[model samples]
Every structure is written in structure tokens, then in C-alpha cells.
Target: TVLYYDDEMLLELKSVVISNCAVGHGGRVIIPTEIKEGKLIIAVLQGEVTVLNTLGERAAKNNMVA
Candidate 1:
């Protein structure tokens, strides 16, 4: 599910693997370091997102909103 602006879906990501998806405002995500086996797992229900693995560092760090 995806919404641009208040469209709906709000934002949902559960055990979802991603190679793309760069939204803003919340549920952040960034892992474009030339894509070294890049991977951005998601499990948020509210806000916060800043995971960067694949040897890039920043294993996981989100506000965590169940």
C-alpha cells in the first residue's frame, strides 16, 4: 500500500523487503550506498525509519511504533 498525500493506507510495511521506496515525512528509509546487497526491511506502524545494513552500518534505528 502507498499514498502520496493523505490518500489513505497511511503506511504499512510488515516484514516487507524492499529495493526501492523513498517516501518522506515519516517511515523513513535510506540504503543507496551503491547497493551493496542492499536491503531495507520494514516493521513500522506509525513513524520513524533509518535502517541501513549491508555492511553500510546502522543496523536498525527507528522510533518504533507498534
Candidate 2:
């Protein structure tokens, strides 16, 4: 799952594996890394997020400014 700090929401990315990234929010950003062909689930509780993948990097937010 890819997260954007400015968007203030969690994204359930699909058909991709996530690795070597950091999750800053209170909840979890579930990526399809294990299955390799499954749906990604992003559960946000609080704070912002910055998701980094092989293609590029992005950020997400929840009330607080990044």
C-alpha cells in the first residue's frame, strides 16, 4: 500500500510488494508482500505517512502536518 501524507488517508495498493519502507502512523499499512498476488490493506489510526517503493516515494497525513 502507498501512503501520501498530504492526502490524509490510507490507500490499499494492489498487485505489488512493499519492502524497505517505514510506517509512521499509529496503525498499520498492509502491503501484499507475502502473497505477491493479493490485495493491500492500509489501516490508519493517527499521524502522517511516507511510503517509499521502487517506482518512487509518497506521503500521507491524518490531521497533523507533515
| Top TM-score prediction, candidate number | 2
- State residue 11's C-alpha deviation in candidate 1, in Å: 21
Give TM-scores for every candidate, taking all chains together and pairing residue i with residue i: 0.18, 0.21
Encode model 1's per-residue lDDT on 19-38: one tens digit a residue: 55565677565444443133
Model number with the top lDDT = 2
lDDT of each: 0.35, 0.37
Q: How big is the positional error of residue 35 in model 1, measured in Å on the Cα after superposition? A: 22
Cα RMSD, each candidate:
15.0, 13.8
Residue 39 of model 1: what lDDT? 29
Off by over 4 Å in 2: 1-14, 30-66
Error of 1 at 46 (Å): 16
